[model samples]
Target: MRGTPTLLGRPVPLGEVAWLTVVWLLLWGDLTVGNVLGGLLASSVVVWLLPLPTLDSGVRIHPVAALVFLVRFAADLVLSSFRVAFWALRLGTSPPVETVRVRLRTSSEVMTVLVTVALSALPGSLVLEAELEDRELVLHVLGIRGDVRATVQADVTRLEGAIVAAFGTPADREEIR
Candidate 1:
Protein backbone atom coordinates (compact mmCIF):
# COMPACT_ATOMS: atom_id res chain seq x y z
CA MET A 1 0.00 0.00 0.00
CA ARG A 2 1.17 3.48 -0.73
CA GLY A 3 2.03 5.53 2.37
CA THR A 4 2.68 9.18 3.08
CA PRO A 5 5.59 10.68 1.18
CA THR A 6 8.73 11.38 3.18
CA LEU A 7 12.05 13.18 2.74
CA LEU A 8 15.35 11.66 3.92
CA GLY A 9 13.45 8.74 5.51
CA ARG A 10 11.41 11.15 7.63
CA PRO A 11 7.74 12.08 7.15
CA VAL A 12 8.43 15.80 6.88
CA PRO A 13 7.07 17.90 4.04
CA LEU A 14 9.55 20.51 2.88
CA GLY A 15 6.87 23.16 2.39
CA GLU A 16 5.62 22.81 5.95
CA VAL A 17 9.15 22.76 7.28
CA ALA A 18 10.07 25.90 5.39
CA TRP A 19 6.89 27.74 6.43
CA LEU A 20 7.32 26.75 10.07
CA THR A 21 10.92 27.84 9.96
CA VAL A 22 9.93 31.24 8.60
CA VAL A 23 7.36 31.58 11.37
CA TRP A 24 10.00 30.61 13.93
CA LEU A 25 12.42 33.21 12.61
CA LEU A 26 9.70 35.85 12.70
CA LEU A 27 8.83 34.92 16.29
CA TRP A 28 12.46 35.31 17.31
CA GLY A 29 12.73 38.58 15.34
CA ASP A 30 16.10 37.48 14.05
CA LEU A 31 17.63 35.68 11.08
CA THR A 32 20.98 34.34 12.26
CA VAL A 33 22.65 31.08 11.28
CA GLY A 34 21.99 29.52 14.68
CA ASN A 35 18.40 30.65 14.60
CA VAL A 36 17.90 29.17 11.14
CA LEU A 37 19.33 25.82 12.20
CA GLY A 38 17.28 25.82 15.38
CA GLY A 39 14.14 26.63 13.42
CA LEU A 40 14.81 23.78 11.01
CA LEU A 41 15.32 21.31 13.83
CA ALA A 42 12.29 22.52 15.78
CA SER A 43 10.04 22.44 12.72
CA SER A 44 11.20 18.99 11.68
CA VAL A 45 10.63 17.60 15.14
CA VAL A 46 7.16 19.18 15.38
CA VAL A 47 6.08 17.78 12.02
CA TRP A 48 7.38 14.30 12.80
CA LEU A 49 5.89 14.15 16.28
CA LEU A 50 2.49 15.44 15.18
CA PRO A 51 1.69 14.05 11.75
CA LEU A 52 -1.36 15.51 10.01
CA PRO A 53 -3.30 13.92 7.18
CA THR A 54 -2.97 15.79 3.91
CA LEU A 55 -6.02 16.96 2.01
CA ASP A 56 -6.17 19.09 -1.13
CA SER A 57 -7.95 22.34 -0.21
CA GLY A 58 -8.23 23.44 -3.85
CA VAL A 59 -6.98 26.98 -3.29
CA ARG A 60 -4.62 28.90 -5.55
CA ILE A 61 -3.48 32.52 -5.49
CA HIS A 62 -3.56 34.77 -8.54
CA PRO A 63 -1.24 37.66 -7.79
CA VAL A 64 -3.04 40.20 -9.95
CA ALA A 65 -6.46 39.32 -8.58
CA ALA A 66 -5.11 39.13 -5.06
CA LEU A 67 -3.75 42.64 -5.39
CA VAL A 68 -7.08 43.85 -6.67
CA PHE A 69 -8.83 42.21 -3.72
CA LEU A 70 -6.43 43.77 -1.26
CA VAL A 71 -6.87 47.23 -2.70
CA ARG A 72 -10.65 46.99 -2.67
CA PHE A 73 -10.61 45.58 0.86
CA ALA A 74 -8.47 48.44 2.07
CA ALA A 75 -10.86 50.97 0.61
CA ASP A 76 -13.80 49.18 2.17
CA LEU A 77 -12.03 49.06 5.50
CA VAL A 78 -11.37 52.79 5.44
CA LEU A 79 -14.92 53.66 4.40
CA SER A 80 -16.43 51.36 7.02
CA SER A 81 -14.22 52.83 9.68
CA PHE A 82 -15.49 56.31 8.91
CA ARG A 83 -19.11 55.15 8.84
CA VAL A 84 -18.80 53.40 12.17
CA ALA A 85 -17.11 56.41 13.72
CA PHE A 86 -19.91 58.67 12.52
CA TRP A 87 -22.48 56.37 14.05
CA ALA A 88 -20.60 56.26 17.33
CA LEU A 89 -20.46 60.05 17.56
CA ARG A 90 -24.04 60.62 16.50
CA LEU A 91 -26.68 61.79 18.96
CA GLY A 92 -28.99 59.78 21.19
CA THR A 93 -30.41 57.46 18.53
CA SER A 94 -28.41 54.33 17.64
CA PRO A 95 -27.80 53.30 14.07
CA PRO A 96 -30.35 50.86 12.71
CA VAL A 97 -28.85 47.41 12.90
CA GLU A 98 -30.03 43.94 12.03
CA THR A 99 -28.90 40.35 11.77
CA VAL A 100 -28.68 39.65 8.07
CA ARG A 101 -28.42 36.17 6.65
CA VAL A 102 -26.44 35.94 3.44
CA ARG A 103 -26.50 32.90 1.18
CA LEU A 104 -23.18 32.28 -0.50
CA ARG A 105 -22.88 31.03 -4.06
CA THR A 106 -19.64 29.16 -3.46
CA SER A 107 -19.41 26.62 -0.66
CA SER A 108 -15.66 26.08 -0.60
CA GLU A 109 -14.35 26.08 2.95
CA VAL A 110 -11.40 28.27 2.05
CA MET A 111 -13.63 30.79 0.35
CA THR A 112 -16.03 30.74 3.28
CA VAL A 113 -13.24 31.41 5.75
CA LEU A 114 -11.81 34.21 3.64
CA VAL A 115 -15.21 35.82 3.33
CA THR A 116 -15.85 35.52 7.06
CA VAL A 117 -12.56 37.10 8.01
CA ALA A 118 -12.88 39.89 5.48
CA LEU A 119 -16.40 40.79 6.56
CA SER A 120 -15.63 40.65 10.26
CA ALA A 121 -12.64 42.91 9.83
CA LEU A 122 -14.84 45.73 8.56
CA PRO A 123 -16.00 48.10 11.31
CA GLY A 124 -19.78 48.01 10.85
CA SER A 125 -20.16 44.32 10.14
CA LEU A 126 -19.50 41.20 12.16
CA VAL A 127 -20.02 37.63 11.03
CA LEU A 128 -21.85 35.87 13.87
CA GLU A 129 -22.01 32.36 12.42
CA ALA A 130 -21.18 30.39 9.32
CA GLU A 131 -23.46 27.52 8.40
CA LEU A 132 -21.27 25.36 6.19
CA GLU A 133 -23.94 22.89 5.16
CA ASP A 134 -26.30 25.70 4.25
CA ARG A 135 -23.58 27.78 2.63
CA GLU A 136 -24.88 30.75 4.58
CA LEU A 137 -23.45 33.41 6.89
CA VAL A 138 -25.32 35.22 9.60
CA LEU A 139 -23.95 38.70 10.16
CA HIS A 140 -24.76 41.51 12.53
CA VAL A 141 -24.65 44.67 10.48
CA LEU A 142 -25.00 48.31 11.55
CA GLY A 143 -26.32 51.39 9.68
CA ILE A 144 -29.29 49.70 8.07
CA ARG A 145 -31.63 52.03 6.18
CA GLY A 146 -33.86 51.74 3.13
CA ASP A 147 -32.91 48.79 0.92
CA VAL A 148 -29.88 48.22 3.11
CA ARG A 149 -30.38 44.47 3.00
CA ALA A 150 -29.99 44.42 -0.76
CA THR A 151 -26.93 46.65 -0.48
CA VAL A 152 -25.36 44.38 2.11
CA GLN A 153 -26.08 41.31 0.02
CA ALA A 154 -24.52 42.93 -2.99
CA ASP A 155 -21.47 43.93 -0.95
CA VAL A 156 -21.03 40.35 0.24
CA THR A 157 -21.43 39.02 -3.28
CA ARG A 158 -18.84 41.45 -4.57
CA LEU A 159 -16.47 40.46 -1.77
CA GLU A 160 -16.97 36.78 -2.60
CA GLY A 161 -16.29 37.45 -6.25
CA ALA A 162 -13.10 39.25 -5.35
CA ILE A 163 -11.95 36.41 -3.09
CA VAL A 164 -12.81 33.75 -5.66
CA ALA A 165 -10.90 35.64 -8.31
CA ALA A 166 -7.88 35.91 -6.04
CA PHE A 167 -7.53 32.49 -4.38
CA GLY A 168 -10.22 30.05 -5.45
CA THR A 169 -9.98 26.73 -7.29
CA PRO A 170 -10.45 26.65 -11.06
CA ALA A 171 -14.05 25.52 -10.78
CA ASP A 172 -14.74 28.10 -8.10
CA ARG A 173 -13.30 30.90 -10.19
CA GLU A 174 -15.40 29.90 -13.15
CA GLU A 175 -18.55 29.54 -11.06
CA ILE A 176 -18.02 32.94 -9.48
CA ARG A 177 -17.59 34.66 -12.82
Candidate 2:
Protein backbone atom coordinates (compact mmCIF):
# COMPACT_ATOMS: atom_id res chain seq x y z
CA MET A 1 0.00 0.00 0.00
CA ARG A 2 1.57 3.21 -1.14
CA GLY A 3 0.99 6.57 0.51
CA THR A 4 -1.73 7.32 -1.96
CA PRO A 5 -5.02 5.89 -0.82
CA THR A 6 -7.75 5.11 -3.31
CA LEU A 7 -11.41 5.71 -2.74
CA LEU A 8 -14.00 4.92 -5.38
CA GLY A 9 -11.22 4.46 -7.91
CA ARG A 10 -9.73 7.84 -7.03
CA PRO A 11 -6.31 8.38 -5.58
CA VAL A 12 -5.88 10.97 -2.83
CA PRO A 13 -2.67 11.47 -0.95
CA LEU A 14 -2.53 13.67 2.12
CA GLY A 15 0.14 15.82 0.56
CA GLU A 16 -2.14 16.45 -2.38
CA VAL A 17 -4.93 17.44 -0.05
CA ALA A 18 -2.71 19.73 1.99
CA TRP A 19 -1.29 21.36 -1.10
CA LEU A 20 -4.69 21.92 -2.63
CA THR A 21 -6.18 23.21 0.59
CA VAL A 22 -3.29 25.52 1.23
CA VAL A 23 -3.49 26.96 -2.26
CA TRP A 24 -7.19 27.47 -1.92
CA LEU A 25 -6.83 29.03 1.50
CA LEU A 26 -4.15 31.38 0.26
CA LEU A 27 -6.26 32.38 -2.67
CA TRP A 28 -9.43 32.89 -0.68
CA GLY A 29 -7.61 34.03 2.45
CA ASP A 30 -10.07 32.48 4.84
CA LEU A 31 -10.79 29.40 6.92
CA THR A 32 -14.46 29.18 6.22
CA VAL A 33 -16.13 25.86 5.36
CA GLY A 34 -16.97 27.04 1.89
CA ASN A 35 -13.33 27.61 1.04
CA VAL A 36 -12.24 24.39 2.71
CA LEU A 37 -14.90 22.34 1.00
CA GLY A 38 -14.23 24.10 -2.25
CA GLY A 39 -10.56 23.20 -2.09
CA LEU A 40 -11.37 19.60 -1.24
CA LEU A 41 -13.87 19.38 -4.06
CA ALA A 42 -11.41 20.83 -6.51
CA SER A 43 -8.67 18.49 -5.41
CA SER A 44 -11.02 15.53 -5.59
CA VAL A 45 -12.15 16.47 -9.04
CA VAL A 46 -8.61 16.74 -10.30
CA VAL A 47 -7.57 13.52 -8.71
CA TRP A 48 -10.55 11.67 -10.16
CA LEU A 49 -10.47 13.16 -13.63
CA LEU A 50 -6.74 12.80 -14.16
CA PRO A 51 -5.62 9.24 -14.08
CA LEU A 52 -2.15 8.63 -12.68
CA PRO A 53 -0.24 5.47 -13.40
CA THR A 54 -0.60 2.91 -10.68
CA LEU A 55 2.76 2.10 -9.18
CA ASP A 56 2.95 -1.52 -8.04
CA SER A 57 6.66 -1.61 -7.47
CA GLY A 58 6.24 -2.18 -3.75
CA VAL A 59 6.49 1.47 -2.75
CA ARG A 60 5.49 2.36 0.78
CA ILE A 61 6.30 5.58 2.54
CA HIS A 62 8.07 5.40 5.86
CA PRO A 63 7.05 8.53 7.72
CA VAL A 64 10.39 9.14 9.37
CA ALA A 65 12.43 8.25 6.33
CA ALA A 66 10.28 10.43 4.13
CA LEU A 67 10.72 13.31 6.56
CA VAL A 68 14.46 12.78 6.47
CA PHE A 69 14.44 12.90 2.71
CA LEU A 70 12.39 16.08 2.79
CA VAL A 71 14.87 17.72 5.16
CA ARG A 72 17.86 16.71 3.06
CA PHE A 73 16.17 17.79 -0.15
CA ALA A 74 15.38 21.20 1.36
CA ALA A 75 18.95 21.65 2.51
CA ASP A 76 20.20 20.67 -0.90
CA LEU A 77 17.82 23.13 -2.48
CA VAL A 78 19.25 25.98 -0.41
CA LEU A 79 22.84 24.98 -1.20
CA SER A 80 22.00 24.60 -4.89
CA SER A 81 20.47 28.05 -4.91
CA PHE A 82 23.71 29.55 -3.63
CA ARG A 83 25.79 27.65 -6.16
CA VAL A 84 23.49 28.72 -8.98
CA ALA A 85 23.77 32.30 -7.80
CA PHE A 86 27.55 32.04 -7.84
CA TRP A 87 27.49 30.70 -11.37
CA ALA A 88 25.26 33.54 -12.45
CA LEU A 89 27.50 36.17 -10.80
CA ARG A 90 30.82 34.76 -12.01
CA LEU A 91 32.31 36.40 -15.13
CA GLY A 92 34.42 34.91 -17.90
CA THR A 93 34.62 31.62 -16.08
CA SER A 94 32.71 29.11 -18.10
CA PRO A 95 32.14 26.03 -15.99
CA PRO A 96 32.93 22.71 -17.60
CA VAL A 97 29.83 21.63 -19.43
CA GLU A 98 29.41 17.96 -20.21
CA THR A 99 26.93 15.18 -20.63
CA VAL A 100 27.36 12.29 -18.26
CA ARG A 101 25.71 8.90 -18.36
CA VAL A 102 24.50 7.46 -15.07
CA ARG A 103 23.37 3.89 -14.79
CA LEU A 104 20.36 3.64 -12.49
CA ARG A 105 20.23 0.81 -10.03
CA THR A 106 16.55 0.02 -10.31
CA SER A 107 14.65 -1.66 -13.13
CA SER A 108 11.36 -0.28 -11.83
CA GLU A 109 9.94 2.36 -14.13
CA VAL A 110 8.44 4.19 -11.16
CA MET A 111 11.77 4.47 -9.38
CA THR A 112 13.49 5.55 -12.55
CA VAL A 113 10.97 8.29 -13.14
CA LEU A 114 11.13 9.46 -9.54
CA VAL A 115 14.90 9.62 -9.56
CA THR A 116 14.94 11.38 -12.91
CA VAL A 117 12.55 14.05 -11.71
CA ALA A 118 14.48 14.55 -8.47
CA LEU A 119 17.82 14.83 -10.23
CA SER A 120 16.43 17.20 -12.82
CA ALA A 121 15.25 19.55 -10.08
CA LEU A 122 18.84 19.97 -8.92
CA PRO A 123 20.55 23.09 -10.25
CA GLY A 124 23.06 22.83 -13.13
CA SER A 125 21.81 19.40 -14.15
CA LEU A 126 19.16 18.33 -16.59
CA VAL A 127 18.13 14.83 -17.56
CA LEU A 128 18.54 14.92 -21.32
CA GLU A 129 17.19 11.43 -21.76
CA ALA A 130 16.66 8.17 -20.02
CA GLU A 131 17.37 4.80 -21.55
CA LEU A 132 14.94 2.68 -19.65
CA GLU A 133 16.17 -0.26 -21.66
CA ASP A 134 19.49 -0.11 -19.86
CA ARG A 135 18.21 1.80 -16.82
CA GLU A 136 20.54 4.71 -17.53
CA LEU A 137 20.09 8.46 -17.69
CA VAL A 138 21.99 10.92 -19.88
CA LEU A 139 22.43 14.10 -17.87
CA HIS A 140 23.66 17.48 -19.04
CA VAL A 141 25.50 19.40 -16.35
CA LEU A 142 26.60 22.99 -16.50
CA GLY A 143 29.67 23.66 -14.25
CA ILE A 144 30.91 20.21 -13.44
CA ARG A 145 34.22 19.94 -11.59
CA GLY A 146 36.37 17.57 -9.59
CA ASP A 147 35.71 14.20 -11.15
CA VAL A 148 32.31 15.33 -12.28
CA ARG A 149 31.61 11.94 -13.73
CA ALA A 150 31.95 10.12 -10.42
CA THR A 151 30.23 12.93 -8.54
CA VAL A 152 27.19 12.89 -10.77
CA GLN A 153 27.03 9.13 -10.65
CA ALA A 154 27.25 9.14 -6.86
CA ASP A 155 24.66 11.87 -6.54
CA VAL A 156 22.19 9.92 -8.63
CA THR A 157 22.79 6.79 -6.63
CA ARG A 158 22.37 8.69 -3.37
CA LEU A 159 19.13 10.28 -4.50
CA GLU A 160 17.84 6.88 -5.56
CA GLY A 161 18.84 5.40 -2.22
CA ALA A 162 17.09 8.16 -0.29
CA ILE A 163 13.95 7.72 -2.37
CA VAL A 164 13.95 3.97 -1.90
CA ALA A 165 14.56 4.25 1.80
CA ALA A 166 11.76 6.76 2.17
CA PHE A 167 9.07 5.08 0.09
CA GLY A 168 9.96 1.50 -0.73
CA THR A 169 8.93 -1.77 0.85
CA PRO A 170 11.37 -4.19 2.45
CA ALA A 171 11.44 -6.30 -0.69
CA ASP A 172 12.07 -3.21 -2.79
CA ARG A 173 14.98 -2.20 -0.55
CA GLU A 174 16.46 -5.67 -0.93
CA GLU A 175 16.02 -5.29 -4.68
CA ILE A 176 18.37 -2.27 -4.47
CA ARG A 177 21.15 -4.75 -5.23
* Clash number for each model: 0, 0
Q: Residue-wise lDDT of candidate 2 within 12-112, one digit each (tens)?
A: 77676778778988999889999999998887777667756656655788999899889888887777777777888889777678899999888777778
Where in model 1 is the C-alpha error above 4 Å? 1-53
Per-residue error (Å), model 2, residue 13? 14
Worst 10 residues of 2 by lDDT: 50-59
- After superposing all C-alphas onto the true structure, candidate 1 shows an RMSD in angstroms of 4.1
Error of 2 at 30 (Å): 13
Deviation from native of the Cα of residue 75 in model 2, angstroms: 2.0
Best by lDDT: 1
Candidate 1 residue 39 C-alpha distance from true site, Å: 6.7
Clashing residue pairs in candidate 1 (N, C-alpha, C atoms within 3 angstroms): none
